[model samples]
Target: MKRRILVVDDQRHMANVIKFNLEKEDFEVILSHDGGDAIKKAFDCCPDLILLDIILPKKDGFQVLKEIRKKTITPVIIVTSQEDEEHKVQGLDLGADDYITKPFGIKELVARVKANLRRLEYLNLPKKSNIIASEDLVIDISKYEVKKDGQVINLTLREFELLKFLALRSEKVFSREQLLEEVWGYEHYGDIRTVDVTIRRLREKVENQSGKYKHILTKRGVGYYFRRI
Candidate 1:
């Protein structure tokens, strides 16, 4: 089946451009001009991925993202004109899969879409070991699920992959650049800051409220690693 994508943008031309480009790639594209409709379409269409614009009519992207996250783990890539680091961090913190600034090349946008979808595809495959357990944390590779203390933990595809890769090689440190290549499937030239953002988000999700991370540990100058139970 051709993958479906929801493109949410108030700008008609922008939305049309994305839709046209994505259709060329053989993806089924759905468009929503407002946040209200975007959230509705997200649940109704059950799209494989979403291209979400930060500024939209009715509710705005962040609100729509929060609503969508409350129900589904569908991958979301924030497309915005904003270039501020704070805005990017906010979107990532709210569970956005990726962030792309406006005036970006169409090919770059398409590449990011493919990359996020590719990760999702990789996550859906069957695995040999299937499950990795360490104390209260459990990672089910087959089901693509993670649980801490028997309670299901909601993780984005990238977050799950990062944790899985490190936990499988517990106590082994990986630099940000290495992690970008290994976990993100990006080259060494990829942004290392992305690794930091992802790590912060992962820590927020998996670590307890007290801020003690038992699973993912920071190596300070180096990078990060999963603790050996």
Candidate 2:
């Protein structure tokens, strides 16, 4: 089955350009010109991924992303002209899987899209053990579910992958660059902030709020690793 993608941008030219390239990559592309329409189509079609823009008619990208995060965990990559650090942080903090500035190369955009989809595919695969348990936290590989103390925890696709990767290799330290390559499959050296944000998110979901016990630990001046406890 071809993976479907929602291309949400107000500019017709930009939308068409993205749609054309994605179709070449064998993806089923759907386009929405406004944030409201994008959200509607997103739920209606439930695309495998979304390429969102910041500026829109009914709502901005942040608003649309907020609403989407409220309902689904679908992978979203913000493709916008907004190059400010604040915008990037805001988008990622709101559960966006990835962020790409405008004037991005088609190869880079497609690479990010494929990387996110690949993570989703990996998460959907059957596992040898089917479930990974560490203390009170449980990760069901077969079902792509995570629960802490019997309570379901919502994690974006990337966050789930990061946590699962670390937990499966409990106690083994991996540098941010190594994680980017292993977990994200980034061929080129990209911003380490991506890993930082994901790690922060994983901690938020899987760690105790009281700081009583930590599942993911940072090695000062080194990298990160997961402990089984």
> Top model by lDDT, which number?
2
lDDT by candidate, in order shown? 0.87, 0.88
Model 2 gets an lDDT of 0.88
For candidate 1, write residues 193-216 as lDDT tens digits. 778899988888788879888989
Residue pairs with backbone overlap in model 2: none
Candidate 2 per-residue lDDT, tens place, 1-229, comes to: 9999999999999899999999999999999999999999999998999999998998999999999998999999987797678888788888998889988999999999998898888767666657888889998877778999999999888888888889889999999999988888785835778888888878888888987557899998899998886
Clashing pairs in 1: none
TM-score for all models, in order of appearance: 0.93, 0.94
Model 1 regions lying over 4 Å from their true place: 188-190
Error of 2 at 52 (Å): 0.6
RMSD of each: 1.7, 1.5
Q: What is the Å distance of residue 7 in model 2 from its true position?
A: 0.3
